[model samples]
Target: MDALQGFGELGLGSRLKRISEHLMKEGQLIYDHFEIDFDPYLFPVFKLISQKDGITNTEIFNAVGLTQPAVTQSIHKLTKKGLIELIDDDSDKRRKIIHLSPKGKTLLKQLQPIWKSIDSVIKSFGMETSSSLISHLNSFEHKLKTHSFSKSVIKSLGNRHHSIQISTFQNSEAEKTAFYDLNEEWLRTFFYVEPFDEEVLSNPDKYIIDKGGHIFFTKLNGEIVGTVALMPLPKQNTFELTKMAVSPKHRGQKIGQQLMQYCLDFAKNLGLPNLILYSSRKLENAIYIYRKYGFVEIPVEPDCHYKRCDIKMEIVF
Candidate 1:
């Protein structure tokens, strides 16, 4: 076992790092052979900026799988190298957009064939290894987002307890407040709220109800105890289950399950192909309920809006 030891059972980080370093080393050689002054590690960020021009630094970070600081550093390096520039958005004075410079565009033109060659090699690597390496990496990252390694270790440590009823989100401002309150309570308790959370929770009527999504609330004696949202995707009979929240004090009452059942039934009645959801592994009881309803894991969509989403699951008819 020692002779054939791999990252020692749970060394996903180490394994990934080693794999990235190996590829980067080979990639650097390719760059050197071509005398391209660009670092291969910086390529993803550059390419992301090119593809998502006028996007914020944080957007580039999310799209390219890098930390905010790392992305910022790369941006600075590119700025210095005359490959890109950061311009502030006019309407939003605080927003800065990332744009590729003409030099960068020209460089990419020169490197296009080299990129094709690397692409071919990557495709061959997938065939030789009998794995879709890039896709699997994406799926792995998505799974990690759904559940952190730390929570995965400790979720089943103790028993869970809660119970509660379901109500649909009417246009009433009171229900609107409750929806925000329930979801915000859960987010603040388990994870800090991201900008996307703020946007959705702040304006469910505008972003959800008006857009044809449904919000269901769990009730206890006519009091809104929990809430779940069903967001319809454009041009598809698909719905994304999102913004589920049961008040912290009311968790053990199993309100979440009841809400989930109602949500599922709602989708099923709509005759949709499936219902999709984004959640983390840390929410053990929730995931259990989802899986109980036959929610199997699937790869997350690349253009997913939420940074908090790590796992994509579906309940197909």
Candidate 2:
């Protein structure tokens, strides 16, 4: 009944292209469901740009194994979408180097978890042995027909979210140590720990708890994998959502978002006037998440608490 199946090995290239297109279409649907502005066709080029940090058009063309014109067009599309920017090379003013824009970095954070889910689902399909390329293709196509790829990915993400648990600060020493450890892990990874950070993290009870503030931790399968603090600010009826960190191994599982949502809900229930947060502009993905949660950028004072605080944001209840 199917002419392509009848053609067999002779149509291998065409069949592969057809399957690629199908997967891409499903990828677009997945992005749509998540409200992400992206084109699945540009994923190869986009992914390359993200990994390379900075690259040239020629390099992208070679790396992606695409025609020069195709690479150029993909670059144009990414630029138009405000996901990337081209800057003049310092060595050669005529040469242009590509880098991810702030929006692109934000999109990367949103996409990485989804990418993992996609990889997991596709890898599952390839687990069984197949006799030939044609046999594998046939089985893959059949599985696609029977299963909704986009739905499966969404379900996978949902299951991950459901498995996580949020808990308030407890008196356990291990829990207290997690607060310091998780915060220290990220600080050491991205920025060095300041004396102020050390003082506060080392004594959360004296600084945060006794001062009418709250701390929250995220547990994944009984492991404390993330922590956040809602510390009372100098301003009346306000709190600063600070010292938030997710364990390195659990970074991509939306643990940060969960802690953020819990803090917002906790603040709301207490009838707080507003919640403020200080952050570095260098943390673009984190800033994007703040904005996503309805936090608006506010001016940072000349004497802000942390030296690394370049930006301040707040959300009113």
Candidate 3:
């Protein structure tokens, strides 16, 4: 039992502080997982600045309800970290305007989805009915303990990414070209397109679709942004997950991972026994994601069908 809970109303302030610290630590872990260099404690000030391009220190202090000196110190730290810049106010030379630096803007782009996930998870914790402040805190803490806050946030992000619709491969001319072009884009980037790759990509319907296989694509606002396919293997009731690619413009949005999940679900619905994939170890991020999705590495045959493949992985349903 927490001693702070024993103090009841008398320890309200300490209780709130303890909760705040716990949340801040979790927030920091989330940022670190995304490889973002940000302090969760500085969020209020930074978020306020992000809202208003040319905000003033006085305005930040007033809006966040922080002491003037604390707000000033936050602005100082942000400036020192190169996340925000202080510029002379055009109307008043004595006053300074705060703006996010270019690096900060880039970071914000990376952080928006993460913030959405955090907001979603926190809002979910508020759904329980509680009679009093302390009771509410207890319920919230219980929920946090029951479900990992960080994992919840990450799962929320996956759901957000799924908002981009994934559809089965339609035999439309445009979609056919998309399937070919998307695969070619990645192949040319990481490895040369061998004759086998050209023939397979050029004729997905013949090589994959007609051979008792399936293809899936993710569309963003009616534009096909990503795709993956499952080709039937010679072994009965097994398929090779292959040709996964996301448009370069949409690479960072987890479209690839979303496609992987969609294919897994499709395979499960079909009652397939297992899914196999051949990938190169040089693609570290893709390899890691495959492993995360429960794909175990297997020995690659010396005469692997695809010359570019150095690693093979499989997941049993």
Candidate 4:
């Protein structure tokens, strides 16, 4: 008899329950080495608070999809352990602001290397498979947020660039030509508009050299296929992500996501609180990538360069 028939005869629901218990035990054994409590829900609480510090209890409850009492109990436990603290809102005495304590911050900082090590171990099987998995997970998260859940229907267009390099622009004509040539094709496909003046295309190198911002380019076999510019915004404790473009032939290869991850990792290493980017509505793929990387849409300001651009996104590091 088939396994299903056997299970049906032996109470499939009970067998599945036992299997779940066995998996939980295995998971616990795997996590015991890290000395982590291994409550999957707790990390989400910490992440939510890290993203929006001083959030209210009710807001946490809603965001985490936990009942009010469950959230209250978790908060109580975390507070008692000195992982988090509650601060009273000055304007509204009734509202208590929840935030991570110094110990919690230290714990999070310490967990970074451990998480990265675990990630590397998990992704060591195959580079292409690992990249595809990460991209699919990001796309799934984006779709879930937009209430557009679908199965793994992502199609890969065969043209994929394997190697990507990051570097500051060199003050050479060849480098300038490569930058502009990449951006020219990118703008045409990404924005679907007529190309900008040749001056602006050539100005990134000079602008970065003058403004003290870093220019990183993605090169595939000596050809520039993607580019991103990170510059300081006028506001205090904020940085701007600018000129993120990828070549048309390399669209679905998750190059844009990798570039954004690089920018975010750079910002975090610099200890910046937030990073901002201005994007247009027409570029849905770019917008989706931004959102996948935890960028929340915010109100646009009048001074934004692209008048047709109506979307602004910000992410707290």
Candidate 5:
């Protein structure tokens, strides 16, 4: 393993790329087995275009996390294959937007079940492993942006990494205030708060704790920075993770990752087999974290609590 993966995270560019290439080969085989004319390395670009039709090339680079040249080459391939088309923007003739051609749309429609199978198999991987991979990747990227990885390694080469403390709500006024403040800050930023949000945020003691649920908070430097709730379902052994948020000042600092880790551990400790969540597509960052922890999007419930929820996902352990 040392020969295969040297120096751990401090030196892992080649190792990560090696693992990625190996996985990409497996993914290509999956597509080939289904007789789909797709390249696994280019799938992210295609999928992003499908999800965000008419999105610009720059947007694809950001959303797909690929180099501009890589996205450009894939787009060229798709266009040449007649699976996608680049159209000049009506508002800005200089800019071209990417969207699926009729051929791509119909072909994807036909491959829906194949995609479902791949998604299911990936979700079958260990929840903790998948979650940690996504969490660490996000943390590395965040750290890299704020301070280069090489610099960070020199600064804290031998010391333990910064960690957050998790605490269960104690019904203190200050804790309740933090809970409401944190959740409200995020809700207002992305979506309007609904009546149900008010009902739960205002009285977690009644709606959550007293009703077989637990709310956990993440504290950093003696301040409550994030909160999450695990509400037991009416049915047995089921739960929902709701009202999760971290301070904007502390956002992208891996506070949410700690909150989620606590929730996942607590759920398993209590013999829960699955954890569900409801969110919107607009909350792409949140969705990525959820999926990292093995949450797969399920059909939306007809009577979900939040009006803003367009996507429902769950991790079935």
Candidate 6:
């Protein structure tokens, strides 16, 4: 039998259908309230233009996976509505730069309150529930992108319950030392290049104390099994997710996804608008997580210390 029939046999089809309908209605309500002609295509286009000003129409089409004419049509409508404007590129006369018009900015400003209302509704449900939904969405997105792993792996991972925990690291020596010792081998084996420094390992308290970065660990018992670090970026409203390492024995357990969810929630709680990360294709699992979390690959900057890293991912909140 097909998937739908199987789900019906399991008595879950009706529930699943209800969920789908609820989500569809909720999405439509959001778009309607914003007074913007909402389509699946428009959200990404708006996100791209809002974040990367002066983007060309061709670039927007490519980035958002839309046909040139379709994008142009949408742009024309938005322009007529006074939400966007096309300007001639000084460097390349052949290309026209797309930007949010003053009216677009005003709409965005107006929509901010609506977005916050939606967010508040979600938050009212509680942090754990919101975090769980975000985690599931991120996982689904990652699976679609990488096309890695087999059906068996997916099934096994799906059966497990993943959770995130956030806490401030106590400025205590023993706790810090213990975390370092437990994670040392996992870090060494997974991140052979640019392994956690001995100094940092020897003094976790000092590292967090002096550096002011939050240390988040993932535990599957009394033992710490995975970790991710959020360090301050040079500029305000941004942070770097670093030192994300999961124990080899727990590789397929979806521990990495949980850790990433924790980091994302941490950033969101701080009201930061963006989070940046550096990773290598060597760790396919990690790259998949980054992409699953709405991160897009960007040009790598020079003077990056990790020689193995050739990819950089950034997510704008």
lDDT of each: 0.70, 0.86, 0.83, 0.62, 0.72, 0.61
Evaluated with lDDT, which candidate comes out highest?
Answer: 2
> What range of 10 consecutive residues in model 5 has the weakest lDDT sum?
152-161
Can you give the lDDT of residue 63 in candidate 6?
87
Once fitted onto the true fold, the runs of candidate 5 whose alpha carbons sit more than 4 angstroms away are 1-163, 235-237
Per-residue lDDT, model 6, residue 50, is: 78
What does candidate 1's lDDT look like per residue over 1-317, in tens digits? 32112334355566577557766766665544343456787888887777764778878877878788888888888887777867888988798888887656756664665666666555533443315544455444444445432233223222233234566777788898998887876676556798988998998877788888998887776778778898877755678898888765554445666677888787788887888888876554456668878999999878777776778899898
**Every model's Cα RMSD, please?**
17.9, 7.7, 9.7, 18.6, 15.3, 19.2
State candidate 4's TM-score: 0.47
On residues 1-317, what C-alpha lDDT tens digit does candidate 4 reach at each position?
A: 33532444345555445534543453343333233333434656777887775899989988999788888878886776566879999999999999987656655664554445434432431233324433443343333344311111111112334667766677678767766777666555334433333455678655555766766778778877788778656554466787776665554355666777888898899888888988877554456567877999999987776655789999986
By TM-score rank, best first, the candidates go 2, 3, 5, 1, 4, 6
Comparing 3 and 6 on lDDT, the stronger one: 3
TM-scores, all candidates, are 0.48, 0.62, 0.53, 0.47, 0.52, 0.46
Q: Which ten residues in a row have the lowest lDDT in candidate 1?
A: 153-162
Give the RMSD in angstroms, all C-alphas superposed, for model 1. Answer: 17.9
Once fitted onto the true fold, the runs of candidate 2 whose alpha carbons sit more than 4 angstroms away are 1-61, 66-152, 156-158, 235-237
Query: Which parts of model 3 have CA positions greater than 4 angstroms off?
Result: 1-163, 235-237
RMSD score of candidate 6 (Å):
19.2
Superposed Cα deviation of residue 32, candidate 2 (Å): 11
> Per-residue lDDT tens digits of candidate 6, residues 160-196?
3344343556655645655666556654544443444
Query: How would you encode candidate 5's per-residue C-alpha lDDT over 96-158 as one tens digit per residue?
Result: 988997657755664555565555544433223335554554443333345433232223222
For candidate 3, lDDT tens digit of each residue in 1-317?
87887777888999888878988999987865553557888899999999996999888988999998889888887886667978998899999999998656766787888898899899998789889888888888788778889888876776434458889877999989999999887677556798888998999989899998998999987889999999888754589999898776566576777788889998999998899999987665577778889999989877788987999999998
